[model samples]
Target: GKGSHSNDVGAIQADLPVPSDVLIYYYEVTVKDAGERGVIAVGFADVHFRLSRQPGWEPNSYGYHADDGNKFHNSGKGEEYGPPFVQGDTVGAGIHLENREIFFTKNGKKLGAAFQNVKATLFPTIGLHSQNEHVEINFGAKPFQFDIEGMIAEEREQRQLAVLRSRIPAHACHDIVCSYLKHYGYAETLLSFDQGAYTEQVAKDEETPQAFGLEDRKRVRNMLFEGDVEGVRQLLIGKQPQLAQLQEDPLAVGGSGSGHKGAPGEPFGDAFFHLSVQQFIELLRQDKIGEAVEHARSSLSTFQGRSHQHDQHLQDVLALLAYKSPGQSPVGQFMSTAQREKVADIINTAMLESSATASASGSGSGSGTSAGAGGG
Candidate 1:
């Protein structure tokens, strides 16, 4: 059925309340039946405004005219706004509330902003002049061809980032990045970080309490990789001065100097047993049966009665001796490259734990170290 412009206004029978949250409100119009150069307008107007002329012809209304693709508002038709609407062409009108602007699209292609600073409450509207000028109005009951939600989210994300920028100091954030770069052996990145625009703001004295510096971590990690247990011991003692005493007299066997009261054999006890086991295993791998036996008797024997894990590991190391080709037996699994890697991991983890314990003690006296799993 064709809607004739009885008095210039031909509003759709339905009206919708536009939501405030959405960045833009969209309406699509499709011309179905019309005369040559037929005039059809699609836009928004006050619900009470007579749809006498095109939506924008009245003071509180806005419209995109299809005849010349001109914009109309407050009884005045403005410049070209969109492609002329012919039969079967869809014209979409969008009301952007954020900027108080309105725009039109011809066949889904934006024709640019049509009006600015629109503040009046309006309803979806359309107008036609010809008797057979038929048009369909879609108030978004179906999915839009454009990704409006994605566009809105992207805009909102920018706004949120702006808010964050105003709150967090730039230097503090970059310092974390500096730490990460050093951690991953990105020396050039670390150097470049110092040359960044934030260099002046990042004072050297403003050190974020890093438990283990990257250089120290890398040095210790390399020592362990090369089966340098003595070097690992020296590095740990140097980083954690207290460890020097703990190494001489392990905490588990009532070493009185340790600050905590029986803080569980978790830290020092675990590190001692694992390192001693690795030394014993290394001796066996070198086929120094006599030295390996002496190491087990002197270092590994203390852990046998300390914990079940220690006892189990000790037994496994002893089992390695039963095979004529000790490196070829099931117990020889511990002699594989994987086992050597585990020794490095144990040292790294101990360094982290010791650093964390020291920091959490609130002494705030030593360098900070972190534990991270190394990728082989």
Candidate 2:
């Protein structure tokens, strides 16, 4: 029930049938009578209610209520913000759904407020000032409105991408890029790929073999980090047949045979060859040398003949096998048992030292400073 108090300069009471365990009543009080007239500065003492467990009514605790209002969760405890909203030109009040954030305003303006974890309905009390000082208490019922913020950085990134698509180049290798996009789980947005003035791709001279250079390496790196592992894997699988034929009977880019017409004896860098080598190394570390060697041979068959450096690395890896432990290690097959133990000790010590250094470096690299993931 809503009520109004006129030029009365005394305490008074109004009845409300709010069986609500969580009651939020908004009030607008204009203290027109300036003659020492103070109203429900803190409306808590004036509000009253009782839970279903009780037959009779009791004073509702306004300081704080446990699950006293609506809630999607059970966050413990609630408190009022700021001092008791004693007096203002116009005072306002509101109650948050149990632990819910609430903004109360008088005449649509903000004011000091209290919060609660209110569950169930309630009939809360209100006052003009100090439990009915010669002040007016005017309150009305209203619905609560809410707003929430999301990942702004992610949203900003999406917006920027949209702007770029409107201003960049139109996709030329549209089909291939679309395939990549699908592989990466991006919607087929080839039309929106760029927004700048569109330009056609310029043809490059292909007579030179080194011309491709590290460009393919960059392409591989982008593909690897693009998070389309399955799509990339599928692409790799589809190309595997071609790669297999190329390996079975090596041919130049122009079909010059064996090595690309002018392809380097070993064009692959140590890093490039290490992916498969490390695969075998890990297997060997697991004491699966037979399986490791099998994997190594297969990888070598596919790639070694194409690169002289890869062939050399394969030899080094074979030699590394000669440095394994005494009982189960492969090194003992080629080296004496004593030599094997000595080599094992050296490798272990080096690894420990390197690990220690890396740990120290990683720890020292940060003084707790960091920015968002997309920060430049």
Using all chains and alpha carbons, the TM-scores for the candidates as numbered come to 0.44, 0.23
Off by over 4 Å in 1: 1-9, 167-376
Every candidate's CA RMSD: 21.3, 25.4
Residue 224 lDDT in model 2?
Answer: 34
Candidate 1 lDDT tens digits, 317-343: 889878778889988888876676676
Q: Of the candidates shown, which would achieve the greatest lDDT relative to the real structure?
A: 1
Pull out the clashing pairs in model 1.
Answer: 8-52, 9-51, 9-52, 57-75, 69-81, 210-368, 211-368, 211-369, 212-368, 212-369
List the global CA lDDT of all models. Answer: 0.66, 0.35
lDDT of 2 by residue, 51-93 (tens): 2111111334342211121111112133334323333344444
